[model samples]
Target: MNLAELSQLDGPSSELLYNFGLQPVSNRFLSGNCQNSAPTFSLELRINRDSGLIHLGKAFPVDELKPRYSWLTCFEPEDHLDAMVKTIINLPGVDKDSVFGAYSFKDDSTLQRLDYLGYTKQWRIDPEQDLGISDPCANVETYQAVFTPTVAQQICQNHGAADVIIVRHVVEHANNLSGFLESIRALIKPNGYIVWELPDCERALEVGDCTTVWEEHVFYFTTFTFKLLLESAGFSIVHYESVPYPLENSIVAIVQEGKGQNNPNFSDSRIVQEEIDRAYRFVDTIKFRRHAIRNKLENFRENVGRIALFGAGHLSVAFLSTLGLCDLIDFVVDDNPNKKGTRMPVGNLAIKGSEALYSEKVRLCLLGINPRNQSKVIAKHSLFEEQGGQFASIFPGSEVYLEHIS
Candidate 1:
């Protein structure tokens, strides 16, 4: 569909910036021999003029779209979590005795770090177990579950209101942002604090990083938009930081309820124009890059023996499918054992272990993993390079990029 069609589809209050066509649900890793095609939906990014929120044009069903997460913070660098825990604990009225609660298993690493730093009283909300959920399709298994105000009330009733709620990387997946925030507020005590982390999209938008746009994340938040969103949701940002990492940087925010004020800057004409301008640039940059990358891969396929993409994360899925590079890739390599024998969504390419690089004789492997961890992966699979296999970045501007491809 064209721009005109999308604008009409989402209403005039929203401006359509980019359309990613039909993309398969990113995390639906299939069994290796599954012959059925993975389900897909139209992925489009648009900005709401009224709220200044950048979001998806269409909202997919929560149950079908909720991810079976393979991501764990323990596998990542500890510096970010170290800084985050230090920031929250240093806040007044927060101590080891203060209750800490999280929405899912994803927050276990952060809670463990908090415990290490003396905040030992931590509680995790298991929807099925704690909330008495019996249905298999309740969509509570993942962090993507939207905590309504009622759900929050029940949580507070079952296990007294938390002194601090740690919601890491879950807010962006929220289809109902306001409800999600209000629910979290309900779960926290009046004097409690909320510490949350999510991908900072400002850098990605400026550089037009296609990896930042995912089917799972309904909203793409810049620092400005994030603060505005929190304030609008009745929270005041007490502390904020952009934790630097590869691909997308994480936004860590410590906030308190009932302390928000309507910032005049939110409605500034200049700010609105600036957001629109960035959206335009993002569209142009992505369009140009997609064309260039597609051309490069077409030529590379003729010369290169076989191509495999490293990393089966959502970013890798977006990079391949959004840019239509799936057909060019022979298979995807991921270290996660759970994904090794599975299949990627759109392309249905077999997800293989790192050993596939040597066994399959993959001549060229594009790195779709985080740039920070790329060196470690390459070192672990050093034998692949020793056998004349080459590694290159799927996208340009990263530290580990192919001069020819970029």
Candidate 2:
């Protein structure tokens, strides 16, 4: 059947499964190879209800299952499917012998042809593009390489004299985390250390930040789970700290090579479980707050004449999706030339440049950026304010009105 037919058939069931924490499989075009002569195939992703065990059909194309260039490969690709399955089997609520089925597409089939998967398009950063800040570690050896655990091992091997290899933002969405950790262990000399920096899911849970669970970020690491994971990977944690960053939580883990033994005494599974429990409680408390916020936005939409959303980052997409603000806003405005004219992620809203601010019909601009960029955003649009433009800020759980500058 065509994509429309398949979507219609699967949509309700998919929603039902997803709401229950089970990931229902869907047929999607392979990344980059969508235009290939062979017909695109469907993948059956069976997620265990309790353990998050993800399994796939054996016939799934290797490239499509684990696109080397795609972030999903690093996050939870088929290569890590076995590990996910193992984890799921160890969970409380799983039927070990359940059989799953797979489906295929043929040239003669009535299904509508889909273009190759757009995985590469998601993070295709231009090499020459500047992000307004000089490289902080410009003097440090610039390593032009892929971000993988094996790559981390190689870095340690190449820099033999280095005592510690600090990896910032490298282990966020790792699929084969066990393998990656093993590689890191292999590279470390006796007494050598490895530092991993990642997002703290505990903080995100405390703040009721649903945006933390996006497609790009598949795993949420609580301190306990993180510690357990590290120990399992053969690293003894020297230090662990949680930092406060509004947009993204931070965790710094210092690990050192040990006496070739996995220490079960350091396992913090109970601590991780407690943090998860706290997260669930926090989520429950925010339900009413979220409802109130939605009501307020709906009221504003009914009263406001012309509204435009400013910012096209992930936050904007999450706001639009979570708050159901698509019909309320006219268009999205962004400073990034790359995102301009492209559809916003998840929300699929058409993105426009800052020039959209000049439109006389737009009475208000809703800022969807993080607080750090608030002042710069206001300053950049200062000229527009002189002509009676209004501004507002939309954060995760709150919205505030700003005065129009002369």
Candidate 3:
């Protein structure tokens, strides 16, 4: 994003430019605040040109010890974290007070739920040591500061401060994982656990999905590469599990702060190379896929007229931008009531409630989201199916053009 555009953000601070470093694919826009009021400030996305990766410019981790309205806004990609935490706490001999949460601002609700799940006294670690001055845009006094990233500085600042730090959905945005992990090692209890969660690159390619590739995500991980990287930083993988099947495929990796003889399977060169091959292949075919999706939309327009999108999450933004598919859309439709009247993150479409889709007689609602949950989404929003709405498919084992509701 340019200086002029950066000047307009509701919350622009030195933290953004200091950590994000200014190159981007598009201008900033208001995205979801973890899909709710979240008291957590909403941050924007920026891309690194030299390396194709997504970076969440702002990093202000907040601990929601106090319950507030948490007004519903948009669905955060941080969904399913509640379940993940529940499972983590179930581990035997867990230290309640030592359970610290790091690397997020909007995940307070999920972290707060950990108390009920048997985790007590969770501390929200802010990686931004400096809050820097606010952007001169100066409109809303409440939303004027941008929190920047200083992983090493902040981690050192909190040296030996955490026994168990839970980092969820935050690592992929790191440009320097080794440095970040080293800082984290300094803060962690000598043998404390650092549970990490992120979307899987291998799965993204296997399914022909490229929407996960965005300006905000700089590094993608395979279980093995991540394990090797962590081990190199004097950390040991205690447990690792690849989520079998889900809308956005991901993995849960639990690591300890010391290096040891652990995880023999981390040396699989074959699977490691396979993951690399898949990522390269996805890059190779992205333009073609975008063209193919555009053609599919055009054919749909020829017969059905301008349509809308059913989601407004990060994946949706990435897909629309990557394929130049935003203009082809009339508007966006979402199940989240809080998102109504909001604009699409990367385009001009107004987000409307489910009722609006039917009122407009939307011929099709591009399920511009992860396809794993397509059946469940359609089933819940039966009006779309009963009213003869359709969706376009661009993933593996799926037909081209519009696919009817089955």
Best candidate, lDDT-wise? 1
Model 1 collision count: 0
Best TM-score among the predictions, by candidate number: 1
Between candidates 1 and 3, the lDDT winner: 1
Q: Against the hidden reference, what TM-scores do the models get?
A: 0.88, 0.58, 0.66
- Candidate 2 vs candidate 3: the TM-score winner is 3
- What number of clashing residue pairs does each candidate have, in the order they appear? 0, 4, 14
Ranking by lDDT: 1, 3, 2
lDDT of 3 by residue, 1-406 (tens): 3212222222232122112122223223344433422132333433222122223454332222111224523233555666677666765456665556554554566667777766665666443332332323211111112322354345536543566676666666543444455555555666677887777666665556756555545455666555555654556667787775554556788887565543334345566456555545665566567777678777877886668887766567667766677778888777666666666546556778878777888887777656666666677778776777776544455442243322
lDDT of each: 0.76, 0.45, 0.55
Candidate 1 TM-score to native: 0.88
Model 2 lDDT per residue over 1-406, tens place: 1112111212322211122122211111122213322223432222222221121212222233232221211211122223322432332322322211101111101111111211111111111231121333221011222224555444444434233333445454343344445544544446555656667767655666544543333345666556656665567777676655556656767677655766544334465346545655545644554576556656655765567788765566555654455676777887665556655433345677888888646667888777666767879888867876777776543335332211
